[model samples]
Target: MTLHTAIVKTEENKISSEEAKKFILSEQNGAESIFVGRVRNENSGKEVTAVTYDVHDQAVIKSFQSICSDAKSKFDKNASIFLEHAKGYVSVGEISILIAVSSAHRDEAFKICRYILEEIKHKSPIWKKEHYIEGNEQWLPGYSLRPKEEIK
Candidate 1:
Protein backbone atom coordinates (compact mmCIF):
# COMPACT_ATOMS: atom_id res chain seq x y z
CA MET A 1 0.00 0.00 0.00
CA THR A 2 1.25 3.49 -0.81
CA LEU A 3 1.09 5.72 2.23
CA HIS A 4 0.25 9.39 2.08
CA THR A 5 3.19 11.50 3.10
CA ALA A 6 3.01 13.12 6.53
CA ILE A 7 4.20 16.65 7.22
CA VAL A 8 3.46 17.22 10.86
CA LYS A 9 3.02 20.63 12.43
CA THR A 10 4.58 20.70 15.89
CA GLU A 11 3.74 24.16 17.11
CA GLU A 12 4.14 24.29 20.88
CA ASN A 13 4.45 20.51 20.76
CA LYS A 14 7.55 18.46 21.29
CA ILE A 15 8.87 16.43 18.37
CA SER A 16 8.77 12.66 18.78
CA SER A 17 11.04 10.40 16.78
CA GLU A 18 9.15 7.34 17.87
CA GLU A 19 5.88 8.80 16.67
CA ALA A 20 7.42 9.66 13.34
CA LYS A 21 8.82 6.17 13.00
CA LYS A 22 5.49 4.59 13.71
CA PHE A 23 3.83 6.76 11.16
CA ILE A 24 6.21 5.88 8.38
CA LEU A 25 6.66 2.20 9.08
CA SER A 26 4.97 -0.15 6.65
CA GLU A 27 4.86 -3.86 5.92
CA GLN A 28 5.98 -3.34 2.35
CA ASN A 29 9.01 -1.27 3.30
CA GLY A 30 11.95 -3.36 4.33
CA ALA A 31 14.14 -0.49 5.46
CA GLU A 32 13.62 2.69 7.39
CA SER A 33 16.01 5.60 7.89
CA ILE A 34 15.43 8.32 10.42
CA PHE A 35 17.16 11.62 11.12
CA VAL A 36 16.57 13.57 14.30
CA GLY A 37 17.89 17.09 14.75
CA ARG A 38 18.50 18.33 18.28
CA VAL A 39 19.33 21.71 19.71
CA ARG A 40 22.96 21.91 20.73
CA ASN A 41 24.28 23.58 23.85
CA GLU A 42 26.76 25.77 22.01
CA ASN A 43 27.34 27.39 18.66
CA SER A 44 30.66 28.96 17.61
CA GLY A 45 31.87 28.94 21.27
CA LYS A 46 28.77 30.80 22.43
CA GLU A 47 26.67 29.05 25.04
CA VAL A 48 23.23 28.48 23.69
CA THR A 49 20.44 28.84 26.23
CA ALA A 50 17.60 27.92 23.93
CA VAL A 51 16.42 27.89 20.36
CA THR A 52 13.04 28.85 18.99
CA TYR A 53 11.49 28.13 15.62
CA ASP A 54 8.86 30.13 13.78
CA VAL A 55 7.36 28.74 10.65
CA HIS A 56 5.02 29.88 7.96
CA ASP A 57 2.88 26.78 8.08
CA GLN A 58 1.17 26.96 4.74
CA ALA A 59 4.26 27.76 2.78
CA VAL A 60 6.47 25.34 4.65
CA ILE A 61 3.99 22.48 4.25
CA LYS A 62 3.70 23.21 0.56
CA SER A 63 7.44 23.17 0.17
CA PHE A 64 7.67 20.00 2.20
CA GLN A 65 5.13 18.25 -0.04
CA SER A 66 7.02 19.43 -3.08
CA ILE A 67 10.24 18.07 -1.67
CA CYS A 68 8.57 14.77 -0.91
CA SER A 69 7.22 14.59 -4.44
CA ASP A 70 10.66 15.29 -5.81
CA ALA A 71 12.13 12.56 -3.67
CA LYS A 72 9.48 10.10 -4.80
CA SER A 73 10.27 10.86 -8.43
CA LYS A 74 14.01 10.62 -7.97
CA PHE A 75 14.01 7.70 -5.57
CA ASP A 76 11.39 5.03 -4.93
CA LYS A 77 7.80 5.99 -5.52
CA ASN A 78 6.69 3.50 -2.87
CA ALA A 79 8.79 5.15 -0.19
CA SER A 80 7.01 6.75 2.75
CA ILE A 81 8.12 10.16 3.96
CA PHE A 82 7.47 11.50 7.44
CA LEU A 83 8.59 14.93 8.62
CA GLU A 84 8.02 16.79 11.88
CA HIS A 85 9.41 20.11 13.10
CA ALA A 86 9.23 21.98 16.40
CA LYS A 87 7.75 25.46 16.36
CA GLY A 88 8.60 26.95 19.73
CA TYR A 89 11.35 27.26 22.30
CA VAL A 90 13.47 24.15 22.55
CA SER A 91 16.13 23.69 25.17
CA VAL A 92 19.52 22.24 24.43
CA GLY A 93 19.44 18.54 23.55
CA GLU A 94 15.74 18.61 22.80
CA ILE A 95 14.55 17.37 19.43
CA SER A 96 14.01 20.08 16.86
CA ILE A 97 13.08 18.06 13.83
CA LEU A 98 12.55 14.50 12.63
CA ILE A 99 12.77 12.92 9.18
CA ALA A 100 11.86 9.33 8.57
CA VAL A 101 11.85 7.50 5.28
CA SER A 102 10.87 3.94 4.56
CA SER A 103 11.44 1.95 1.41
CA ALA A 104 11.93 -1.58 0.16
CA HIS A 105 15.66 -0.99 0.00
CA ARG A 106 18.01 0.59 2.50
CA ASP A 107 19.74 2.82 0.00
CA GLU A 108 16.58 4.55 -1.14
CA ALA A 109 15.47 5.12 2.43
CA PHE A 110 18.79 6.67 3.38
CA LYS A 111 19.01 8.88 0.33
CA ILE A 112 15.46 10.17 0.59
CA CYS A 113 15.80 10.89 4.30
CA ARG A 114 18.91 12.95 3.67
CA TYR A 115 17.35 14.77 0.75
CA ILE A 116 14.24 15.71 2.71
CA LEU A 117 16.31 17.07 5.59
CA GLU A 118 18.62 19.12 3.39
CA GLU A 119 15.71 20.53 1.45
CA ILE A 120 13.89 21.52 4.61
CA LYS A 121 16.90 23.34 6.01
CA HIS A 122 17.68 25.18 2.82
CA LYS A 123 14.27 25.73 1.28
CA SER A 124 11.50 25.77 3.91
CA PRO A 125 9.96 28.97 5.18
CA ILE A 126 11.02 28.37 8.75
CA TRP A 127 12.85 30.98 10.83
CA LYS A 128 15.06 30.21 13.78
CA LYS A 129 16.42 32.32 16.64
CA GLU A 130 19.25 31.39 18.93
CA HIS A 131 19.22 32.65 22.51
CA TYR A 132 22.58 32.82 24.20
CA ILE A 133 23.40 32.46 27.88
CA GLU A 134 24.98 35.90 27.70
CA GLY A 135 21.52 37.47 27.30
CA ASN A 136 21.84 37.99 23.56
CA GLU A 137 19.82 36.55 20.72
CA GLN A 138 20.11 36.55 16.97
CA TRP A 139 17.96 35.34 14.13
CA LEU A 140 19.75 33.00 11.81
CA PRO A 141 19.76 33.64 8.10
CA GLY A 142 17.69 31.18 6.11
CA TYR A 143 19.61 29.26 3.50
CA SER A 144 18.26 29.04 -0.01
CA LEU A 145 18.17 25.99 -2.25
CA ARG A 146 17.32 28.00 -5.36
CA PRO A 147 19.95 28.90 -7.87
CA LYS A 148 21.22 32.48 -8.12
CA GLU A 149 19.34 33.03 -11.34
CA GLU A 150 16.06 32.00 -9.69
CA ILE A 151 16.50 34.24 -6.66
CA LYS A 152 14.78 37.59 -6.84
Candidate 2:
Protein backbone atom coordinates (compact mmCIF):
# COMPACT_ATOMS: atom_id res chain seq x y z
CA MET A 1 0.00 0.00 0.00
CA THR A 2 1.21 3.49 -0.79
CA LEU A 3 -0.82 5.33 1.86
CA HIS A 4 -1.87 4.83 5.46
CA THR A 5 -3.93 7.27 7.52
CA ALA A 6 -5.60 7.42 10.93
CA ILE A 7 -7.12 9.59 13.65
CA VAL A 8 -5.85 8.43 17.05
CA LYS A 9 -7.88 9.10 20.18
CA THR A 10 -5.43 10.38 22.76
CA GLU A 11 -7.16 8.88 25.81
CA GLU A 12 -6.39 5.40 24.61
CA ASN A 13 -3.25 5.95 22.55
CA LYS A 14 -0.93 8.52 21.00
CA ILE A 15 0.44 9.34 17.57
CA SER A 16 3.74 7.56 16.92
CA SER A 17 6.47 8.70 14.53
CA GLU A 18 8.30 5.41 14.79
CA GLU A 19 5.22 3.61 13.60
CA ALA A 20 4.92 6.05 10.75
CA LYS A 21 8.53 5.51 9.80
CA LYS A 22 8.06 1.79 9.71
CA PHE A 23 4.93 2.08 7.62
CA ILE A 24 6.59 4.16 4.92
CA LEU A 25 9.96 2.48 4.87
CA SER A 26 10.96 0.93 1.57
CA GLU A 27 14.06 -0.36 -0.22
CA GLN A 28 13.21 1.68 -3.32
CA ASN A 29 12.92 4.92 -1.40
CA GLY A 30 15.91 7.24 -1.68
CA ALA A 31 14.52 9.93 0.58
CA GLU A 32 12.26 10.17 3.58
CA SER A 33 10.51 13.14 5.17
CA ILE A 34 8.62 13.25 8.41
CA PHE A 35 6.67 16.03 10.04
CA VAL A 36 5.50 16.01 13.64
CA GLY A 37 3.09 18.54 15.10
CA ARG A 38 2.83 18.96 18.88
CA VAL A 39 0.62 20.81 21.29
CA ARG A 40 2.55 23.88 22.24
CA ASN A 41 3.09 25.53 25.63
CA GLU A 42 1.80 28.93 24.44
CA ASN A 43 -0.25 30.60 21.78
CA SER A 44 -1.12 34.26 21.28
CA GLY A 45 0.24 35.27 24.72
CA LYS A 46 -1.75 32.58 26.50
CA GLU A 47 0.03 29.83 28.37
CA VAL A 48 -1.38 26.66 26.93
CA THR A 49 -1.66 23.71 29.25
CA ALA A 50 -3.30 21.36 26.80
CA VAL A 51 -5.52 21.06 23.75
CA THR A 52 -8.73 19.18 23.02
CA TYR A 53 -9.22 18.00 19.45
CA ASP A 54 -12.73 17.23 18.34
CA VAL A 55 -13.05 15.50 15.00
CA HIS A 56 -15.62 13.91 12.79
CA ASP A 57 -13.87 10.57 12.51
CA GLN A 58 -15.38 9.29 9.30
CA ALA A 59 -15.04 12.56 7.46
CA VAL A 60 -11.52 13.08 8.72
CA ILE A 61 -10.48 9.66 7.46
CA LYS A 62 -12.00 10.30 4.08
CA SER A 63 -10.23 13.62 3.86
CA PHE A 64 -6.95 12.03 4.87
CA GLN A 65 -7.25 9.42 2.14
CA SER A 66 -8.10 11.99 -0.47
CA ILE A 67 -5.24 14.27 0.58
CA CYS A 68 -2.68 11.49 0.50
CA SER A 69 -3.81 10.34 -2.91
CA ASP A 70 -3.68 13.84 -4.28
CA ALA A 71 -0.20 14.36 -2.86
CA LYS A 72 1.05 11.18 -4.51
CA SER A 73 -0.54 12.02 -7.85
CA LYS A 74 0.80 15.55 -7.78
CA PHE A 75 4.31 14.77 -6.64
CA ASP A 76 5.37 11.14 -7.09
CA LYS A 77 3.23 8.19 -8.02
CA ASN A 78 5.40 5.75 -6.05
CA ALA A 79 5.43 7.76 -2.86
CA SER A 80 4.65 5.94 0.35
CA ILE A 81 2.88 8.01 2.96
CA PHE A 82 1.83 7.52 6.57
CA LEU A 83 -0.35 10.10 8.30
CA GLU A 84 -1.95 10.21 11.76
CA HIS A 85 -3.65 12.90 13.81
CA ALA A 86 -4.54 12.89 17.49
CA LYS A 87 -8.07 13.32 18.77
CA GLY A 88 -9.19 14.25 22.31
CA TYR A 89 -7.00 15.74 25.05
CA VAL A 90 -3.37 16.36 24.08
CA SER A 91 -1.06 17.94 26.61
CA VAL A 92 1.72 20.39 25.86
CA GLY A 93 4.70 18.67 24.20
CA GLU A 94 2.48 15.81 23.12
CA ILE A 95 2.22 14.92 19.48
CA SER A 96 -0.84 16.17 17.64
CA ILE A 97 -0.07 15.02 14.12
CA LEU A 98 2.47 12.97 12.20
CA ILE A 99 3.12 12.74 8.47
CA ALA A 100 5.81 10.58 6.93
CA VAL A 101 6.67 10.13 3.27
CA SER A 102 9.19 8.03 1.37
CA SER A 103 9.98 8.46 -2.29
CA ALA A 104 12.65 8.16 -4.98
CA HIS A 105 13.91 11.67 -4.41
CA ARG A 106 14.19 14.28 -1.72
CA ASP A 107 11.96 16.80 -3.47
CA GLU A 108 9.10 14.36 -4.02
CA ALA A 109 9.19 13.10 -0.42
CA PHE A 110 9.21 16.61 1.00
CA LYS A 111 6.49 17.81 -1.34
CA ILE A 112 4.18 14.92 -0.53
CA CYS A 113 4.65 15.40 3.23
CA ARG A 114 3.91 19.12 2.99
CA TYR A 115 0.94 18.66 0.68
CA ILE A 116 -0.76 16.21 3.02
CA LEU A 117 -0.37 18.51 6.00
CA GLU A 118 -1.67 21.61 4.20
CA GLU A 119 -4.63 19.76 2.73
CA ILE A 120 -5.69 18.27 6.07
CA LYS A 121 -5.51 21.64 7.78
CA HIS A 122 -7.85 23.05 5.15
CA LYS A 123 -10.18 20.12 4.46
CA SER A 124 -10.47 17.98 7.60
CA PRO A 125 -13.43 18.39 9.96
CA ILE A 126 -11.34 18.91 13.05
CA TRP A 127 -11.67 21.57 15.72
CA LYS A 128 -9.38 22.59 18.51
CA LYS A 129 -9.96 24.07 21.97
CA GLU A 130 -6.91 25.37 23.77
CA HIS A 131 -6.78 24.99 27.53
CA TYR A 132 -4.77 27.70 29.23
CA ILE A 133 -2.78 27.84 32.46
CA GLU A 134 -5.12 30.58 33.71
CA GLY A 135 -7.97 28.07 33.89
CA ASN A 136 -9.67 29.22 30.72
CA GLU A 137 -10.09 27.75 27.29
CA GLN A 138 -10.86 29.09 23.84
CA TRP A 139 -11.74 27.58 20.52
CA LEU A 140 -9.22 28.56 17.93
CA PRO A 141 -10.34 29.70 14.49
CA GLY A 142 -9.64 27.21 11.72
CA TYR A 143 -10.28 26.98 8.00
CA SER A 144 -13.87 26.43 7.03
CA LEU A 145 -14.90 23.23 5.30
CA ARG A 146 -17.09 25.20 2.93
CA PRO A 147 -15.88 26.58 -0.33
CA LYS A 148 -15.00 30.26 -0.27
CA GLU A 149 -17.64 31.06 -2.86
CA GLU A 150 -20.32 29.36 -0.79
CA ILE A 151 -19.71 31.68 2.17
CA LYS A 152 -21.43 34.98 1.49
For model 2, residues 1-152, the per-residue Cα lDDT tens digits are 87899999999998988899899999999999999999999899889999999999999999999888888889998999999999999999999999999999999998888888888888999999999998999999987767789899
Cα lDDT, all candidates: 0.82, 0.92
The per-candidate count of clashes, in order, stands at 0, 0
**lDDT score at residue 128, model 1, on the 0-100 scale:** 82
Error of 1 at 150 (Å): 8.4
Residue 106 local lDDT, model 2: 100
Among the numbered candidates, top lDDT falls to 2
Worst 10-residue lDDT window for candidate 1 reads: 1-10
lDDT (C-alpha) at residue 9 in model 1: 44
Per-residue CA lDDT of model 1 for 33-98, tens digit only, reads 988899999988989988988878888878888988899899999998877777778888988888
- Model 2 global lDDT (CA atoms, 0 to 1): 0.92
